[model samples]
Target: MVRGKTEMKRIENTTSRQVTFSKRRGGLLKKAFELSVLCDAEVALIIFSSKGKLYEFSNSSINKTIERYQRSVNEMGIGQKTTSQDNLQHLKEEANYMSEKIELLEASKRRLLGDSLESYTIDELQEVENQLEQSLSKIRATKTQLFKERIRQLKEEEKILAIENAKLREKWDEMQSTQKEIVEVETELFIGLPQPRTTR
Candidate 1:
């Protein structure tokens, strides 16, 4: 006959509970041994009876297994903490490097802007002097070119004015000669006596 499913409640009778505990504990230990042997797996089991009697089983040395378990757990925690500490150290070092780089850049910027040159070496000062000298030379060359262009323009204007002044002088000389001829003709026609009758 098929057995009915057993309900998983406490057995009410004390004798029955003790009997069940004894039978179940023996069956559990037997299964643990079988599993370890058949699967070649490590197994550990522990039990306490209602009367405080202890029963235990282990495929290997129980103490060694327990120590290994503790170390595994501790290693997980320690590994995470060690990784975090390493990352933090790397970040701190990187930040220090960046800070030093920024300080150097700021000092270089200050030097370019003509500040803090008292500690500069002779070669560095000479470099700055050479740059300024080149700039001044370019500026002077540009100024000289501008002055020459202005002088050329002024000379061209003087030539044009001289040509215009010569034309004006020619016009004035022509006007003066024409006025002198007219005056002489008018004097001869009006102020002279009738001397033409004796000239026959």
Candidate 2:
């Protein structure tokens, strides 16, 4: 009698799972070999067991098959030709990626240079406009604050200079009075009048 179909679940018994893994891995390698021999096709198989053991098989030298694959890729002119459907799809994907990158670069350039956003799409232009406005506002605020600070400094300097001027004027007045007293005393000495008893 035929057995029921196996359920799609993990094998519970460790020994049974190991046995199954060994059998299936051998069968898979055997089929790969047979296909390579019967159809003259290159085959390479690599398997890693649950226990992390590595296994590998190749119809010919694995390196040779890899070199052949590389040669085929080069012969196809992988970058130059996009004629096939798969190649065309790949090219389209690349084009989309490049377009996005270009947009990002342009946006960054515009931001750095402080350019207006009139030429781009509405959404992109709006974004740029917002950023520019923000930058301008910040610059204006900083400029205003700097001007106020400069004015305050100038006022303080003026006040200081005014105080210094007042002090210098008072010193000039004192110097003039001392000079006048000295001239009067010299005049008395020259005229040979009875010298007034000078105060000690």
Candidate 3:
């Protein structure tokens, strides 16, 4: 059976707690040394006991490792700041593009609705009219296609229904013929296991 999780709290008695802390501190140092040797990592660990006694472990110079950590953290902060600035710039450009596109679409919509045609040249007005006619033609063609598709679907459904109805009718006829045969058998007279001899 799998072992259940044990609840962990602090060791309450002073002697037990101190002993536990000393054992754990030794284990932690051993683990840190193993990690550095096995993984080729620069490891550092520092522990202070309740009596203000210091315990320390390091695979390399602890000062050098601390400096390296600080340098890495600073570089990460700088890289993040640069990335954030780039993202902000990209967002601003996208917003501008969207704004311009919206304005163009709104102006085109106004022209299509015959609301903003006062500024258009004759050629531009003719072009807009042609666009409207083309759009209307495409819409009508699409509508016609949908109606044809619907008609096809209805015909297929009707054919299936007719086939089903024919099958039902055949079953019904078979049932009626069976019932008639039963009635004819029941109506016969002199029903017995042996046949009777004819009289002279």
Ranking by TM-score: 3, 1, 2
Model 3, range 27-62, lDDT digits (tens) per residue?
999999999999999898989998899999989899
Q: Write the per-residue lDDT of candidate 2 for residues 16-50, one digit (tens) a residue.
A: 99998999899999999999999998898889999
How close to the true structure is residue 34 of candidate 1, measured as C-alpha lDDT? 99
Lowest lDDT 10-mer window, candidate 3? 78-87
> What residue runs in model 3 are displaced by over 4 Å at the alpha carbon?
1-94, 186-200
197, model 2: CA deviation in Å?
Answer: 28
lDDT at 95, model 2: 100
Return the TM-score for candidate 2, rounded to 2 decimals: 0.37
Candidate 1, residue 199: lDDT: 50
Cα deviation at 135, candidate 3, in Å, is 1.1
lDDT winner, 1 or 3: 3
lDDT ranking of the models: 3, 1, 2
- Each prediction's whole-model lDDT (CA): 0.88, 0.86, 0.90
TM-score of 3: 0.45
| TM-score to native of every candidate shown | 0.38, 0.37, 0.45
